[model samples]
Structures are given as C-alpha cells and as structure tokens.
Target: MTIMQEITTDSDQRQPIITLQGITRSFGPVQALRGISLALKPGRALALVGESGCGKTSCARIIARMDRPSTGDLYFRGRQFTSSQSSEDEKTYRRAVQMVFQDPFAALNPVFTVAHHLARPMLLHGHAKTRSEVAARVAALLASVDLEGQSTAGKFPHELSGGQRQRVNIARALAVEPDVLVADEPTSMLDVSIRLGILELLSEIKRQRNLALLYITHDIATAAHVAEEMIVMFAGQMIEWGDTRTIIAEARHPYTRLLLSAVPDPDRPFVPGESVEFLRHAEAIRKVSRDASAAIEQIGPNHFTRSVTL
Candidate 1:
C-alpha cells in the first residue's frame, strides 16, 4: 500500500487534516528538521519515533504552530497556511490543532481547579456559553478521559497524580473540539505502569472523535499500540517509515533495527558485559545513520527507508 492508500485506511476517504512537505527548521547554523514530510488524516494515528535530539519535538512544535518551519509548506485541509494569514485564521488553525505536551505538570495551572482548566477552553472557543453549559461540557470532557467528573473536578493540579494530570491535559485539549491532536511523549513523565493507560486513552479518543493524532515518542515499543503508521528519525531526518506493523516486523534501516534491538526482551537473561557491547553497537549504528543521504529505497508496498552512505 502506498501513502495515499494508507491515508485511506479503514476505508475513510477524507483528505489529510494536515500535511508537512519538506519541512526544515534551522536555529542559526544548526538544522533541527531536515526535509520532514508527512500527512495526518482524520481517524488515524502516526507515530514519530527517535532518540533524544532527533528532531521529534521540533516536528511537533511546527505542527502545533508553536514554531514556524524555516522552509517548507504546511497545508491544512489541502490549503497551504502562509505567513500572510489573518490573525483570525491563525487562531482558527491553532484551535483546530491542539497539542498535549510531554510535561503534564507544567501544562496545567497549579492554582486552578480541573473544572477551571477545562471550562476556560470551552468558553473561549465558543463551545459553551452560560456557566451551566460550561460546567456540563467540562464534566463531559473529564468523563471522556475516564475521570469521574464530580470526583475529579474542583481539585488543583497538585492534588492529582501524574497520570491524572496528563488525562486532564488531554481533556483540556479536547475541550476545544480540535480536529488534530499532537501528543508529544504524553506518558514519559508518568510511572511505567500508568503509561499504557494514557496511550489507551489517546487511541480511544482518536478513534471516537475521528481526530488525527501525531503520537511522538522515543519509545518505539509503544508505537505499535497507538499508531497504524510509524516514522523512525535519526539525526533530524526520517530514515525509515511506513505501516507500523510492516516496519516493526521487517525494519530495513540500521538505525531502525538498532531501535528494535534496544527494546527490552523479558525472556532474555542479562549477560555480563552486555551493556558495554550494546553501547558499542549503538555507537556504530549512530555513526552510519548520521551520514546524511537523500536516497530513499522502497522496502515494501508501503515501507521505505533512507539509503546510508556507508
């Protein structure tokens, strides 16, 4: 299957909610993103996976409109969003694309109650008007994320666990009825046991709301759970990407294979000096992956990988 075919997954023929074409972001001499391109269609999730400093957050920032791409075109509903857009248009785009940050605690206001956080967005976005209407909407939003409306509301951020706080952040994002949801490592700050719950919540919300989701994380293992398609980034460039199960089952790039190797094997017993050997192997993979090349090799019907320069 091609990207277009994959885009029409589950037989949905809707156009992509957002598309990034050859996106690049530069900070003076340093380039954070290199020719990044992907399309986010409604009712589908795309996972962006890579190690730290591999431009995952940069891509998310550009998608969220928090940062502009140095070069490249960003299209929303097939129309390019240019710098000349009116403030109202910009606001509309921002409202349509909501982001859930990595730091759940920082995303919420400690002084405000959960009701206040969820109510503010709905009120500002005209989703609700009267106080009663806002309250009802807030309760519905909290309930959607599996939080008990009456029990969870009226509590401050410090009063909630990391997982609960992240759920609240998600509810806050959904309060605006966004068309796209960008979750940048939403579970990284929470306990390991609770991470799966957050991922499940995101997947459920995406399917239920038909919201295009960009699930960005360094953890490749979680990609298979929440996303149908996946991209592996190395040194700011996409080295391999395609159908999540296809790539996960038959990864082609060295970096991609390295990432898979890094996933902990519960059945394998620890061997002495294994850590040293693994680190050495990782360094070797990184060295070759860093050698930039624009050559892309098609690996399968929907799978593709960058050609490494030896």
Candidate 2:
C-alpha cells in the first residue's frame, strides 16, 4: 500500500510544480483530511471532486498555504517547504499560488471597481509599476478571461452577472502571474447555462498560462470538462483517481458510480419511482465508501481505485 503513487497523464510529463505527500489534517477530535497525496503539474488541471465535508477545500487551502497540514510534507518544485520558511520564501510561495474562491461577489471589494481588483494584485506583485502600466495589465487580464476591458473593468462587482463576476475573479487571480491556480467551486454559484463557459475559460487559462490548476468541486460531471486528471474523494480519502476520460468511462468505486448516476442523462428520461430506488442505492454506496482503506488497485495506466470492503 503505497502512500504516494505517481499520477500523470500521457500529455503531461513535466515535473510537478507542487506535490502533497500523505497529508492529514485534524480539527481537535475530528479528522478533516486523511492520507492525501497528489501532484499538480504545470499546463494541466487536476479536479478534486467530492460532496460537502469531504476535505476538498482543505486540500486546496493546504496547497495555497492558507492552512498547514497536521501531518505530511508539502513540496514546491521538489523542495520541501516549512512553516518556518524565510519571509522571502513565504512571499514567493504565496504569490506563486493564488486562489479563486467559491463566492465571486464576496471575494471582491464592493467599494472598488473591477479594474481596481485586478490592478492592485499586479502592482503589489511587481507585475506593473506606473498607472499606465497597471491599466494595460488590467485590460490584458480581463481580455484573457474573455471580458471586454473597457466596459467590464469600470463596473462594480454588483453590476455584473454571477458568471461575469466569476470571470473577473479568475482575471484577478491571473493578474499576479501565478504558476498555480486553485479554483474552489468556480462555477457552482453561476447559472447552469453559463457553467460550461466558465469551465472552458479555466481550461484555456491553464493551457495559455501553463498553470498548475487545482479545480475543486462536488460535481463530477463538470470535472471532465476542465481537468485533465480527476480525483474522487469520499470521507477525507481519495476513492478513485486517474485520467478524467478513463474515470468517466469506467468508474470502479461504488461512490464514483453513485456520483455519475446522479448526473442527469438526456438519453435516460426521468421515470416515476426511479428516484426512490436511486436514494436507496445511493445510501448503500455511501455506507461502503465511508470505510477507509489504505490499499489501492490499479485500474489503468494512470487510474486507481481504493479496495472497498463490500
């Protein structure tokens, strides 16, 4: 039972910019995270999928340096980082990894315009100096996220739609020129019609900036849209993980199957009384998935699923 297994896609062979080895977190008597290990490589996105209270955001916070692991080591570019790191090193790590929070409106300053939100980070990170330079960088950031700089930048967060505000949040994250982007439920708050657009925007940003992206969400279906790789987590443990397409096509874990089953299939129209059966099956899967196991089985070249005691 290896605690750390090398998980890489065929397209991404480059070294991981960030790595988490056997990470665990505890809140007094409660365990928030359990033996988490994964790597985030540049130019690729890894989707951390799980329902609420499954430690997905905990992983993101650890990677973004918002919280420290109760156990396990964190590595940046293969070098182990510590809480006692020098101020310079801390600053470098913070700037290198930026987060796009779940609530787009709350993430921004209401008093300030969209341009202010984007330009402040650029100037603070030394990406821009003069006023003209800041303006240019702000416009460029907005443009990269598919937002029109002239019309969008001057508007307040309240003035924009849910999806547009989210785009602005992403642009603000990019303003720092971060190597790693941790997006926590980037589109869960937006309208369903616009969710795919945000997902596409994230995919494009990952490729163009060559960013090591950590996309956190409970929706497994959307994970396939943005991430090259995926990890399905349950009860603070990774139940299944691998290439996104592989897991979607052939999910081995019961919990993974339950999640996929919940996704509405256009081909399978709703039938009366099916919901009751699904709830019963879903409960059974949850009971089995709650039991943790250190052992894992390889399902494909890059895919793996935990050994569940059925």
Candidate 3:
C-alpha cells in the first residue's frame, strides 16, 4: 500500500488547513525531498522523524513558505496556492501559518523585550490597534504559553533560560492567531531536564488553540510526546508512519527499529567491543533502507512500512 492510502484518517473528512501533495525539492543534483505527502489538520500534530540531512528541516521550510517546493502542489484550505498568490493573499497565508525555529536564542533579538516581540506581531497583523490593546494581548499571549506575564514581559531574551526563551518563541507564533504551527526541533537546544515541559506546553497549546502542528524532530521518543501521527523519513522519503504509540510499540521498518534502539537507556551499559559491531549493523540497515524503489506495505489499521530492497 502507498503512504497516502495508509494516512487516510477520519479527521481527513474535515479539510486540512495545510496539505502537501507529492512535494519534492532539489538543489542542483541533490534532491532534498521526494514525493512527500501529508496533511495538517486543526488540533493535531504530525511529527517528522529522521536523522540529520534526511530533509526534515527542508520539509518544514517548504510548509512554512520559507522555501518553495521544486515540484509539488501546496494547498491551503483546499485551494492551490503554490504557483500563484497575490501580495495580500501571500501575506494572509503567512500570517495564518507561523513557525517556531530550533534555536531559541537566535530566533529572538537580544535588544528586544518579550513584550516587544509579542506586541509587534499583534500590531502588524492588526490583532491589536491601540497601544493598550497590544499590551493586553501581549500579556495574554505570554500567559497562554505559561510565562509569567508581568515578570517575563520586561525581560530580554538573554535574561531568560533556554526553555523560557522557547516559550516566548511559541508565544510570538501564537500572537498572529495562526491556524497552523510548524515547530522545527523546538526542544533540541534546551536542557534535557526541561524538554518534556516544552513538549507538554506544545501539546496543551495545540489543544487550546486548535492549531495544526507539524513537529519536526530527529528523536523518535520525543515524537510520541508531542505528536498524534508520526512519519519516519529516511533519505528524503517516508519509510514508515502511523499512530505514534502504535508505531513505537510495533515498528515494522528496519530503519525505524534502528532509531528506537538508539535511544539512550541508563540500564543498558555500553560494552567496549560493541561500537564496531553496532556501526556495521547500522551501515547495513542504511544501505538497504536507502533503496529508492522500496514498496510500501500497510501493517496495521493506521500503520505502514516500506520494504527495503536488498
């Protein structure tokens, strides 16, 4: 079965806020994405999981309109907008779809306060017309992200912790009242202890705002925390995808298993002689999983895995 067939959910009956159909991107001789298709519906998140250079960020950039697809159709609420979009329409589209970048510190300006960052978007998007309204909306936005409105508003980015800065980033994205939120490794740069809090905040915000979220991450374990549906990509192609808990419980793809097995376990100590053996095994899996002509198979009600040609 193809990925499209397996990804058919009852939620799809409701028109997706953002849809990527056969999206492919390339730069010169290098192809970053290949026949990628997915839908993002309100109040649901689809996690894109893969190692570095597997085109996860490329997919996010395409969806966020930061980069255009080399070949594909991008649809917003069932209307095709990939090829032609007027200036006003484009601006509207951008406002409706917001992005939370990976680097927390880099996303915020050191010179700006939290209130300034939030208020600017609200004023620019016409969410707030008056100075008082912008200030009130800024306070509300910070509160929505669990930041203390009074204390956080007056502080600059450098004054906050990594996790706190990420919260502000999310609040900035929400200021525009976007229907879709694309978070690219939002927790990767934070301390390990606070990652779960950030993930929980994202899940809560999704439910509260009814926002379609595309969570891009390399960590398979973390995907289960923030996403309902999961897509496992390898070499620019989706190798497996399904319900997060289901796929994690019974992963069919060799590549998926390799990723899950790689998760750190304090109980399992590393052996001195295991490094070379593990590297060889991982290399073998990569070689087979990289085959372009792999056939997809539906392995469960919502689960699908690709057959690696060996």
Candidate 4:
C-alpha cells in the first residue's frame, strides 16, 4: 500500500484531527525536515522521538502554526490549511491548537498570577464572557491540573515549584479548550521524579478531553508513558514508526535500537569497559543512519522503517 493508503488504513474509522502530508522545511542550504508525514487523531497521541536537532521542534512548530512548512500540505479535518486563511479562520485554528512549551519558567509571565494566566486565555477565546465566569473557569482549570484553586491560583510562576509551574502551563493550555495539544518536551526541564506525574496528567487529559496530542521528546522511553504510537526520527527523517509497544519491544532499525539502548537499565550493572563499547556502537549507528533514503520497509502489522543510503 502507498503512504496515503497506509494512513487511511491505520486511521481505521476515526478521522485524523490534524494531518501533515509530505511536510518539509528548509533554511538556506539546510533542510530541517524531509518529506515528513503523520497524523494525529482525537483521544490519541503520537510521540516524536529523537536527539536534539532531529527536526522534532520543527514539526511541532508547523502543527502549532508557529512556523510554516516550505513544502507539502497541512490539513485540519481533511481541509487543507497550508495556504493563507482568513482572519476568523486563523483565529479559530490557533485557538484549537494549543502548545505547552518546554520551559515552565519561560512559558509564563513572571508577574502574572496562575489565575491570571488561565483566565486570560478563557477571556480571549470567549470561553468566559463575564468576570465571574472567568474566575470560576480559572479555578476549575487549576483544579484540573491537581492544583489547589484557593492557594495555587494566587501564586506567581516563581512562587511555584518547577512541577507546579509546568502544571500551570498545562492548565493555561487547557483553558483554551483546544482540540489538539502539542507538548514539546513538557517535562524535560523538571526533576526526574516529577516527570512521570506530568506525563500521567497529559495522558489523563487526553482521554478526558478526547484531544489529539503531539508529544515531542528526545527521550524515547518516556514516549511509552504518554503516547499510543511512536515515530523515531533521525537527521530530519522518520527512521522508524509504529505502535509504541511494538516499536519499543521489537525495534527494527539500528537507530531505534541505539535510542532504546541509551535508556538507563536498572537491572544491568554499569561497567567501565561497556561504556566505551556502547559509545562506539552509538557512533557507528549515527554515522549510518544519517544518510538520506526514500525507501520504506514494513516490518510488522503497523511498523515501518526507512532504508539508509550507504
């Protein structure tokens, strides 16, 4: 089957809320993304995993309309949106797609209280027409993220812990009633202990709201926590993609295996000599996987891997 056919088949009965078809972006001579294609459906998430500079943010920016793709089309519910849209349409689109930025501290205004942060979006989006309604909605938003509506709503970004600040950011995103959520490494900056809590919150929100989520992270292991499917990108190309469990358990591509191997293994004791060998293997995989190739091979029922030009 062709790429479009595969998308259709995988989508099953549910239509994709957002679809990226053959998307590509370039800067001068450098191509940041190469013919990337994926779909995000309501109530489900697809994780974009790779090391830094693997074009993960570029894809997220395109989906969030923060940046435009140089080539290929972007669609919302089968309607092409790559071309310029009217003011009203643009406003609607922007409101539907909300982004939770990586940095909790930088995502919010230092001076604004958490209540203000959540209230502003509801007011601007017309979700709350009255001051009282805005206040109520802000309280509910804070509560959704497990924050105390009374105490937490009055605190500023600096007054909260990193995890709390991130929750506030998430609450801000939720305040808009977005159909899609692009969480770009939402927990990478937080302490390791708090990462799982944020991931769990995202999962809960996605199910409760039936929101399509695009989770971008360099840590492949965390993808399993928040996403139903996974796409492993390398050097601006999707090297492997499929069901998250299948991809994690039976990763076919060398690059995908390299990423899994990098995940800390608690059962295996660390050895001094093994570190050098691991580094050598990782370098070898990177060298080969960086080469561009268009050939795609189906490895399983839903899994696919791209060939690397030698």
Tell me how many residue pairs clash in candidate 4: 0
RMSD of 4: 2.7
Better of 1 and 3 by lDDT: 3
User: Which regions of candidate 2 fall more than 4 Å away from where they truly are?
Assistant: 8-11, 268-279
lDDT of 2 at 295: 69
Q: After superposition, how far is residue 73 of candidate 3 from its true place, in Å?
A: 1.3
lDDT of 2 by residue, 1-310 (tens): 4646546534567889898988999999878898888989999899999999999998899998989999998999989984558989998998999999999879988899999999888888799999999988888899999999999989998999989999999998998899999999998888889999998999999999899999999998889889989999998888899899998888778788778877786585223224545557777778888776546888788889887754
User: How are the candidates ranked when ordered by TM-score, highest leading?
Assistant: 4, 2, 3, 1
lDDT at 162 for candidate 3? 95
* Candidate 3: Cα lDDT at 117: 94
**TM-score of every prediction relative to native:** 0.92, 0.94, 0.93, 0.94
True-vs-predicted CA distance for residue 10, candidate 4, Å: 2.8
Candidate 3 per-residue C-alpha lDDT over 124-203 given as tens digits, one digit per residue, 9 for 90 to 100: 88999988898899889999999899999999999999999999999999999999999999999999999999999999
Model 2 TM-score on a 0 to 1 scale = 0.94
Which residue pairs come into collision in candidate 2? Answer: none
* Residue 250 Cα positional deviation in candidate 2, in Å, after optimal superposition: 0.9
How many pairs of residues collide in each model?
0, 0, 0, 0
Best by lDDT: 3
lDDT per residue (tens digit) for residues 1-310 in model 1 = 3333333343445689898878889999888898788889899999999999999999999998888999988888988894548889888998999999999999998889999999888888899999899988988999999999998999999999999999999999999999999999999999999999999999999999999999999989899899998889988888888889988888778788777767786564222223545556777778888766557777776788877743
